[model samples]
Target: MELSNSTLSSVAGLQVVVCVVFTLIFLVGMLGNSLVIWIILCNIKQQFSTVMLILNLAVADFTVLITLPFWIYSFADGWVFGAPFCNVLLYVVHCSMYASVFFITAMSIERFVAVLYPFAIQKWWRRGTIGKLTIGIWVSAFLFAVPVIDQKATHVEHPQCSLLLSSYRQQKGLIVLETLVGFVIPFLVLSICYALVAKRILKMTLQSKSKSMKVIRSVVIAFAVCWLLYHIINLLTVSSILTKTSSPEVSKMLLNISERVENLAGALAVTNSCINPILYAFAARRFQNGFNTSGIAKLFQQLNISIAEKFSNESNIRRDNFQTSV
Candidate 1:
């Protein structure tokens, strides 16, 4: 579809605004998620299946945030980076996206299992098993993104780098693959797990209704909202690609709108990183207390105390020497 100069300018302006919003969201998400990881690893002593899932989710978010500057630079100046860097960046971004979705799905399943079969959890869901599963998820995500790495680069006409699937055939293939692998499969898994979790929670006795259930519900709702937004944007993008003979002006306008929607959804997805920490703070009493009396603060306190004690010890030694000599 052909776009007029004015329409192109408008699209560029919209892209810039979206990029700025994404940058801010990425920065806030990185800081909040990093702190969550620190609190979990350094301060929290007790680890459960939920904590394991959260740790992996934080790692996935961190990986995406680490690559945000590369994308921000590309968006600002067009993709000045060569084909190789573009390929790597696209690969990493997709890897993180898939990893985040997989981790959330896994968390939902874990919650379902814990709720449905609480007695068997200690026997079946040990830390070692979780570690192995986490490694497998990372590996699978990296492999799934391989095609994206191969297909993405800076286009000859458009200065920006993007997936090289502009043709009808290529775009259809990508859309099908992305819909099935990226969204449909994960969404199905999460939905099933959530349904079971909800069923089990509903069956619980009134006395069994607890803070943990509330926390799980919040996380599940947040994850569902994020993915639902992403899925809607993806569907619109697919529709734009499939419809032929559409008016150039209309198509361009639709494309612009889709781009903005996709960007906003992406930002919302990243917000999950920050929201997890808040969920922990509100739902987990132990986490709240641990954050308050964290080892990070304790480390600084210990250093000061040690320095004062050393100085006092040296003074006492000098005083004793002086008294003996006198």
Candidate 2:
């Protein structure tokens, strides 16, 4: 049932390479996320619900990005931080991850409402509403991350940090809860919202629809690519552990594979943290156009103007034209 000598060697080799790759990811992610936060903060005019959500997303991403060095060190040198610090760091990372998902989901919902129910969206655009939603998202994310606090640093065959479960039953239960709440539910809600948005877009005349909608799609796609495999690997790895009592040999083999896959998946997950800034830069016309004269600063200032006011103004102009025709 033991992992073969060759398998152990390969796992070690993969770990070394993954550590180097993750080190690069950490560097890039930190720079990208910091720039995002800086850009948003400078834009005093970027005060709408969308901007608020994005600002919070950048903050969440930055929180997680700072944790990458710890992971990089762990992957390269093993977990030397002991149990308490490991649990604390794990909690922070998970909380940030959950917050990132919630904020992205909020953005998706906002875009959906803005496109399909523009009139009603005005009522929801109040600072009070957005502020409450922001607080709720962070609070919920923190609550969901409580399970990660149970993870412990272990020195079995090698020093590493992992879930502190005493049996496969506990690990299985925890991973299932995490997979459902952390991945499945949010993704489903986002998919439905985006699907409705896309349907409405299709009904509009090609010339009337703006390319800004593409930004939503790109962000959702980035999230999926980054986190889906990692969740799937965790699920399978946990299931393999459940069977380890009957087949320790097979379980050990699968565990080794999972470790390798997790490394790759973990890197991709953090890589997602840096991608939103690039997508926003390319997809949002206003953001792109304002880049020269401290674009973000101008954008933050623009946020002070409610999106509802813009829509109302446009409606008034149209009404005036109709009145003239009469």
State each model's CA lDDT, in order.
0.67, 0.74
Clashes of 2: 14
> What is the RMSD of candidate 1?
14.5
Candidate 2 per-residue lDDT, tens place, 68-160, comes to 787777777788877777778878988999999999988888878777776666777653788889999999999988866754422222345
| TM-scores for every candidate against the unseen true structure | 0.74, 0.82
Q: Highest lDDT among the candidates is held by which one?
A: 2
Error of 1 at 311 (Å): 52
Q: Per-residue lDDT of 209-228 in model 1, one digit per residue for the tens?
A: 33455655677677777767
Candidate 2 wrong stretches, greater than 4 Å: 1-13, 151-157, 204-209, 242-256, 284-310, 313-326
Query: Which pairs of residues have clashing backbones in candidate 1?
Result: none
When summed lDDT is taken over every stretch of 10 residues in candidate 1, the lowest stretch is 299-308
